[model samples]
Target: MTVIVGASAAGLACAEALRRKGYTGPLTLVGAESHLPYDRPPLSKQVLSGDWEPARARLRSAEALSALDATLVLGDPAVHLDVPERAVHTASGRILKADNIVLATGLRPLTLAGQPTLRTVDDALTLRKRLLGCTNAVVVGDGVLGAEIAATARRMGVAVTLAGPQSAPMALQLGPRVASELASLHAAQGVSLRLGAAVTEVSEDGVLLETGEVLPADVVVVAFGSAPATDWLQDSGLTLGNGIVCDSRLRAAEGIYACGDVARWHHETLGRMVRLENRTNATEQGIAVAANILGADEAFLPVPYFWTDQFSAKIHVHGFVSPDATVVEGSASEGRFVVRYHRDGAVTGVLGWNMPKQARQHRAEISLRCPAGVAASTPGAA
Candidate 1:
C-alpha cells in the first residue's frame, strides 16, 4: 500500500503521478482539510478577487479523483508517525499503515493573533467577505502573499495599506531594483506602502509598528511567511530542520519520501540543502518524488519558476533575484522588459515584467550558463 499525506497540490500530484507511472498498488491520500484538493495560488488572486468561485480552484473533478482508485482520508490530521512500523496515526484514531509513505504535509502560514492570513480556502473566503464590507485594510507583510492580497483588496474598492520591514515589497526575493519597480506599481494602484518598519502588533483600531506609528485599518492580513507543518512529526524520528530533511531523491528514510513545501532536500548543483515554498515546486517535486519512489534514481534538480499578477503587471521570474540586476531587453520605463540578475558578475536569475516571452527566451541563457538548481541561492556563472 502507498499512503500520501497532506492531500493538497503536492500530495494529489504525487498520487496522480504514481498512477500515471503505472503504480497499481493500493493508494491512499490523507488531508487535514475536509475539502477536496485545490490550488492555493488562486486563494489570494482569483478567489479573493471574485474572479473565480471557490469550486473553480479544485485541482481535479470529483470523477477524475474517483477514477484514481485511491482512498481519501479527509478532515483527520496526522498526529504521529511510527517509522519502524510505517504507520501514520491520525486525529480520528485511525492508524494508516502503508509500505511506502509520502510526506507532503506542506506549510502553515504564520500570522499575528486574531489577524487574518491566507493559506486555505476557508481563510481566503473569510478574508474576501471582510474585504467586501471593510473600508480599509492593512496587509502586514512585504512578501508575495501580502502584495497579492493588498492588490486584490484594492481592486475590490477597499483602501489598502501594506506594512512591512523591507524598503519595498518582495525585496528579499526580487531584490532592491525589481522590488522598487513593484513599489511603483503598487503605489500607482493607490496602495499605501508603510514599509521599512517592523509590525509589532495588530490592535483593535490599527496595526502597531515598531517606529511608534499606527496604521489604522478595518481589517489586518498577515502574510509575512510560514514554517513547515512538521509539528505532527516531532517524534517521528525524522531529521527535521527548516523542513523534513531528505536526500537528493527526497527520501526522508527507507520507504519514506517527502515533497512539496515541507521537504528540505539537498541540491547537488547548489551543494546545499534547500526548501522551496511555491506552487510550481509543489507539483514538480511531487512528480519527481513519485518517480524516485519507483526506482528512477534521478536527482531532483530544477530551475525554480514563479509568477505574480498584481494589477496590470504580469511578472514572471526564473531563478533567484539578486540586488545586482541589469535590464537585458526593453526598458524598465516601458513597463515591459526582461532583467537579468547577477551575483559576482555571473547570471543567477532573470525577471520578466510584462515580457513573459522575452523572459522565457532568456531562461535558456540561465540553463546554458548556470548550473542546475541555480535558483536556490547558488551562484551561477556567465
Candidate 2:
C-alpha cells in the first residue's frame, strides 16, 4: 500500500493525483481530524463569523471522497514511521505497511503562551461559540490569519484589536506600505490596531503587552504563525528542518516524498529552501510531487503566489519580495493599486491590492528575474 499522511488539501490532492498517475495499488490515507477533508480558508472568514457552519467548509463531498478509491483512517494520526520496517504506527495502534509514503502532515499553529488558537475546524468553531454575545476580542498576531480573525470578529459585532510586534499588520507578507494601507482599512472597519508590541502573557481578562498595556478582551486568539507538524518523523531517519527537508523534486528519502506547508524543499528558481504556507503552494506542490512520485524527476521551482481577503480588500501576490524593499507602484490611497517590490534592478515581486488583472500581467515578467542575489539560469516560464 502507498500510505499518505494527512487529509487536508495536500493529502487529498496528492491522493487524487496518484489516481490520475495510474497508481492502482492499495492506498490508505490517515488523517488526524475526524471530519473528512475540508477547506480551511473559510474557517477564519465565513465560519468564524457564523455566516456558515463547520459542515460548509467541506472541500469535497462524501460522494466525491468515495470516488477517490482510497481507504481512509480518520481521527487517528500516524505517530511513528519505522523506516527500515516500512511501516506506520498510528495513535490507535493500527499498523500500516506501505511500499511508498507521502508526508503531507501540513503545519501546526505557533500560538502564544495562552488563550485560544485557530488552525483547524474545531478551533474556529470554538472561537465562534465564544464570540456569541461577546463584546471585545483580541487577536494576538498581525499576520494574515490574525488580521483575518480580527476582521471577522469585528464584523461579528465584537470590537477587535490586533496586537503584534510588526510595524504594520501582514508586513512580512505584503510589505510595510501595502500592509499599512491594509492596517488602515482594518482600523476604518472598527478594529483596533496595536502594532510594534509583543504579547508578554495571556490572562483570563486580557493580554499583557510588552510595553505594559493590558487590553481587556472577552475573546483572545493567538495567531502567531505556524511550524511544521513533523514531530512524528523525528525517529524515522528522514531529514527535518523548518519542515521535512526535501530535495528539489520533493523527495525526502528513498521511497518517501513530501509536499504542502510541511515540506521545506529547495526551490531551484529561488535558490533556497522555502516552506510556503499558502493554498497555492499546497495544491501546486501536490500536483508536482505526484508527478515526481511517478518518476518524473521535475524540479519544483515555482513563482510563489498567495492571496488574502480582508474587509473590502483583496490582495494577490506573486514572486518573492522582501518586506523592507517593497514600494508602491500606483496610488495606494485609491484602494486599488499594485505594490511592486524590486530585487537588485529587476522587479522580483508584485502585490495587487484589488488590482488583480495588472498583477496577473506581471507574474510572467516577475518569474524571469532571478531573486536579488541568485544567478539566473532558466528564463521565464521554466
Candidate 3:
C-alpha cells in the first residue's frame, strides 16, 4: 500500500505516474482541502479574471480519478506522522498505514491580516468576488503571484498598486534588464508600481510601507511568498529545514519519499540542496520521484522553466537569469525577443518576451552550458 499526502498537482502526478509505471498496489491520496486536485497556475489568471471557471482548473475529471483506483481522503488535514510505522494521522481521526509514503504537502502562503492570498481554487473565487466589487486594489510583493494578481485586477478595471522591495517586479528571478522592461509593461497597462519599499502593515484603508507612505485600496492581496508545509513532520523523525531534507532519490527515510514544493533535495548538477515551489517543478519532480520509487535509481536534474502572462506580454524563461544578458535573437525594443543571461562567461539562463517558441529552441543551450546555477524557478504562492 502506498499513501500520498497533499492531493495537489505533485501528489496527483505521483499517483498517476505510479500507476502508469505498472504499480498495482493499493493506493490512497489525502488532501487538506475538500476540492479535487486542480491546477494552480490558472488560479491567479484565468480563474480570478473570470476567463475560466474554477472547475475547469481541475487536473482530472471524476471519471478519470475513479479509473486510477485510488482511495481519496479529502478535507482531512494530516496532523502527525509516525515514521516508524509509516502511518499518517489526519485531523478527521483516520490513521492510514502504508508500506510506501510520498510527502507532497506543498506550501503555506505568507499572508497579512485582512488580505487575500491565492493558493486554492476557493481562495481564487473568493478574491474574484471581491475584485468585482473593488474599485482599487493594492498587491503586496513584486514576485510572480503579486505581479499576476495586480495585472488581473487592472484588467478587471480596478486601479492596482503593486508594492515590493525590488526595484522592479520579478527582479530577483528575471534579473535587472528584463524586469525593468516588465516594469514598463506594467506601468503602461495601468497598474501603478510602488517598488523599492517594504510593506510595513496592512489596514482597512490600505497598505503601509516602510517609507512612511500608505497606498490606499479597497482590496489588498498578499502574494509575497510561501514556506513548505512540513509542520506535520516536525516530530516524525524526518530531517526538516527549508523543507523535508532528501537525498538525490528524494527519499526522506526508508520506505518514504518527498517531492514537489515541500521537498528540498540535492541537485547533482548544481551540487547543492535546492527547493523549488513552482508548478512545473511540482509535476516534474513528482514524476521523477515515482521513477525512483520503482528502483530507477536516477538523479533528478531538470532545467527549470516558467511562463507568466500579463497584458500583451507573455514571458517564458528557461534556467536562471542574470543581470548581464545579451539579446540572442529578436529585438527587445520591439517587445519580442530572446535573451541569454551570462554569469562568469557562461550562459546561465534564457528568456523570451512574447517569443516562447524561440526561447524553447534555445533551451538546449542551457544543458550544454550547465553552469553551477541551475534555473530554479521563483517560488509561487502554492
Candidate 4:
C-alpha cells in the first residue's frame, strides 16, 4: 500500500506514474484542500485575469482520479506521521497505514504580516475580485510573482506600484543587467517601479514605505516568496535543512520520499542540493521518485528549468546563472537574449528571456551533456 500526502502536481503525478509503472498496490491520496489537484502556475495569470475559472485548472477530474483506483481523502490535513509504524494520522483522526509514503505537500505563499498573497485558487479569486474593484494596487516584492501581478493589474487598467528591496525586478534570479531591462519594461507599461524600497507597514488602504512615504492603494499584495510546507514533518526524523532533504532519487527517509517545492534534492550534475519551485522540476522529480519507488533502477538527473509569462513576453530559464558568469550571448536591451552561466569553461546554466525555442534547445542539449561551445548560441538562432 502507498499513501500520498498531497494531491497537487507532484502527488498526483506520482500516483499516476505508480499506476503506469504497474504498481497494483492499494494507493490512497490525502489532500488538505477540498479542491482536486490543479495546475497552480496559471492561478496568478489566467485565473486571476478571469480568463479561466478555478474548476478548469484541475489536472484530473474526480472520475479520472477514480479510474486510477486511488482513494482520495480530501479536505483533511495530514497532522501526524508515525515513521516507526509507517502510518499517517489525518486531521479527521484517520490512521492510514502504508508500505510506502510520498510527501508532496508543496508550498504556501509567504504573506506579509497582514497583506494578502496569491498562491492558492481561493487567494487568486479574492485577489481578482479586489483587483477588479480597486483602482490602484501596491505590490510588495519584485520577484516573478510580484511582477506578474503588477503586469496583470496594468493590463486590467489598474494603476500598479511595485515595491521591493532588489535593485531591479527579478534581480535575484536574472542578474542585475537583465533585471534592469525588465524593470524598464514594466515602467514602460505604466507601472510604477519603486526599486530598493522596503515596505514598513501594510495598511488597509496603502503601504507605508520605510522612507515614511505612504503609497495610497486599494489593495496590497505581498509576493515576497515561499518556504517549504514541511512544518508537519519537523518531528518525523527526516533530514530537513531548508526543506525535506532528499537524495538524487528523491527519497528523504526509509519508505518515504518528498518532491516538488518541498524537497531539497541533491543534483548530481551540480554536485549540490537544490530545491526548485517550478512545474518542470516538480513533474519530472515526481515521476522519477515513482519509478525508483517501484524498483526501477532509473537515476533522476534533470536540468533545472522554469518559464514565466509577463504581459507580452515569455521568459524561459535553463540552468542556474550566477551573477559573475559572462554574458555569453544576447543583449539586455532587446529583451530577447540568452544569458549563459559558465564556470571554468563548462556551461552551468542559461536564462532566455522571450526566447522559447532557444530555451527548449538549451535544456535538451545540456541534458545530453552537449559541448559548451555548441550550447552557447544566441537566442532564436539556436
TM-score of each: 0.96, 0.94, 0.97, 0.92
Each prediction's number of clashing residue pairs: 0, 0, 2, 0
Which candidate model has the greater lDDT, 3 or 4?
3
Q: Give the clash count for model 2.
A: 0
Q: Judge candidate 4 at residue 317 and give its lDDT.
A: 72
Candidate 3 is scored at a TM of 0.97
Tell me the lDDT of candidate 4.
Answer: 0.80
Best by TM-score: 3
Give the worst 10-residue stretch by lDDT in candidate 4.
373-382
- Candidate 3 Cα lDDT to native: 0.88
The runs of at least 3 residues in candidate 1 whose Cα sits more than 4 Å from the true structure, single-residue gaps closed, are: 367-382
Q: Candidate 4 lDDT, tens digit per residue, 72-120?
A: 9999999889888889999999999999999999887778776789888
Better of 2 and 4 by TM-score: 2
For each candidate, the alpha-carbon lDDT, in order, equals 0.88, 0.82, 0.88, 0.80
- Candidate 4 residue spans exceeding 4 A from truth: 324-335, 364-382
Error of 2 at 119 (Å): 0.9
Pick the winner on TM-score between candidates 1 and 2.
Answer: 1
TM-score of 2: 0.94
Instruction: Give one digit per residue, the lDDT tens place, for model 2 in 58-154.
Output: 9889998898889999999999998877788999999998888888998888766557888899999888989876778889998888999988888
> Model 1: what TM-score?
0.96
lDDT of 1 by residue, 212-267 (tens): 99999999999988889999999999999889999999999999999998999987
